[model samples]
Target: MNLQAVLAINAIGIGIIVFVLSLLRRQRLHIGYGALWIGASVLGMLVVSAPPVFRLVTRVIPTSLPFQAVVVMALSFIFIVLIYFSVQLSALLRRVTDIAQHIGISELEAKSQAPERNPVEVEKRGE
Candidate 1:
């Protein structure tokens, strides 16, 4: 990789790290999400700082170019993150369903315990 490209990558990695840290400080991002961003930024920085390591990775992979290897790695990372978020969403959905069912059951129980009121009697009392 060229010096300019390496510097640009480092700059981007540092920017991401700073942005993640600010979000964490402001409590805008949860720790689990922040950690993933931080890890990605660190990995980017490491790869940018060590061109030889990237070259080695490209050699190990079937990619003809370093850029292709990087792209593949990025896509793989995104896929894994997507799977993680999907699992989290599924759990949240399950919990919400359980809560709604519980509320429905509680409402039924409460209604059964309360005495039924006659509309005619209620209207006469109001008059």
Candidate 2:
């Protein structure tokens, strides 16, 4: 890659790292997610800044275009993030189901304890 292009990619990577850090500091981003983004950005910067790293990636990716390598890296990152979120979503869904089940059980128990009143009687009382 050209020096200018490498510099620009490095700058973008640095910007992403800084942005992720700021989000983490402000508690607007989850620590795990922030770390993931920071890690990816740092890796990107390393790949862009170092000739050896580029050579290694090129060997694996076999792409003449740096942009193509970047796109592959980005797609991999997206896939990883999607998997992580899917796991988190599955856990949350399980938790919500458990909570709802507990609530239902509690309501049933409460109803079993309380005296049964006729609906007509309750309506008359309301009137």
Candidate 3:
């Protein structure tokens, strides 16, 4: 009935969809770390949005603290998830470059191994 409840329920639904789709596709998800992000997002939404849960906490924890803590915690979760993927992306890019370089070097080595084809000797013979 309330806005928060709506949001939380929607978030849970969306998370489940994403998880199912990604898993079914055998998706090589962004650096192989999407599960934690989805889990955190779903759990955080559910915890924050539920009225009864907050009602209980408001008794001991300062009234304002719950809101403040939730905001901070949600932000932290988002930032952490972003950073994890960013690091993974960077690592993947580095590996791609390293592989490319390795392939280039192998190609060069292969070129050099051709029979009867030393550039310097060929030059001298030509003269």
Candidate 4:
């Protein structure tokens, strides 16, 4: 790649890193996810700016076209993020289920322990 192209990629990568840090600072993003973005940006920068690493990646992910490596890399990153989100969602679902069960049990127990009123007297008052 040309120097200009490399510089542009580096600038974009740096911009992404800065944006992710800003999100982290604002509490809009979790540290774990922010780290992922930063890592991706760094990897992208390295792949573009470093020929050796780029060659290695291309060799490992061989494609019919030269630019396919970038496409494959983007797809792989998306797949990883999807898997991470699915795992997080699964864990959260389990936690929510457990919490709901506990709440239901607590409510049941409280109701059982509370004093009971006579249905007949309650109806008479209503009348």
Candidate 5:
């Protein structure tokens, strides 16, 4: 790799690592996701620092270019992560809906059991 490309890649990899660490420190990111981000950044750094790895990958994959292979790998990783998050979101939505239904049912049950009181009787009793 050229000096400029190496420098840029190192910068980006370091930046990603730093950003993920900060998010972890702030409790803004989950540990699982943060670890994945860190791993990706480290992988990027390794790929950029050593061009031979990319060459090996290209040879194995029969890709036209090393960059294309890298792009495909990155995209594939992103797609998998998106699918994982989608499933998690679906589960959370289902739980929330169940909780809401349970709350509604509880309110209805409570109302059914409680005797209705007349406002006029209450007022007269108060007076």
Candidate 6:
């Protein structure tokens, strides 16, 4: 299949699906991710679709291997970065959950031992 054809088809399908999901859902983060996916897909297509760009890179690098190796390397870097960020995000969420649980426990303890108000004192204060 032609690269241009694939790019156009995917761009439309992916963009429409993401737009629909964004409209139907309230999750800004998910929407942002979908947008990022769409952007990256389009960018990837643009970069990889042309033969001249590949030729230019091959000339500049003077590599026996094709430019696809470079593309793979770039993808590996992206995957590594994604994994690192995901781990960091998971750790941050765990800390937040711990803090929330601690706060809930503290609040419950405070409420359980709270002193009761006296009716007599209330009446005297009202008088």
Q: Show where candidate 1 strays beyond 4 Å.
A: 113-127
Deviation in angstroms for 14 in model 2?
A: 1.5
Global lDDT of each candidate? 0.84, 0.87, 0.68, 0.88, 0.84, 0.65
For 1-127, candidate 3 gives per-residue lDDT tens digits of: 3577557656775866587557747865643355565666666666666767655545545545556555566667779878977998899999999999999889987987655577799898995
Per-residue lDDT for 16-92 in model 1, tens only?
89999999999999998999989997897687578687777778766866767767877888999999999999999
lDDT of 4 by residue, 1-127 (tens): 5788779879998999999999999999999999999999999999978898888888989997645886799799989999989999999999999999999989978888755568799798995
- Model 3: CA > 4 A from native: 1-32, 49-65, 114-127
Runs in model 5 lying further than 4 Å from the true structure:
113-127
lDDT of 2 at 96: 100
In terms of lDDT, which candidate is stronger, 2 or 5?
A: 2
Clashing pairs in 2: none
Worst 10 residues of 2 by lDDT: 62-71
Checking candidate 5 for backbone clashes, the offending pairs are none
Tell me the TM-score of each prediction against the true structure. Answer: 0.79, 0.78, 0.60, 0.79, 0.76, 0.48
Kindly indicate the candidate among 3 and 6 with the higher TM-score. Answer: 3
Which 10 consecutive residues of model 1 have the lowest summed lDDT?
61-70
Considering every candidate listed, which one attains the maximal lDDT?
4
Q: How far is candidate 6 from the true structure (C-alpha RMSD, Å)?
A: 8.3
Supply the global lDDT for candidate 3. 0.68
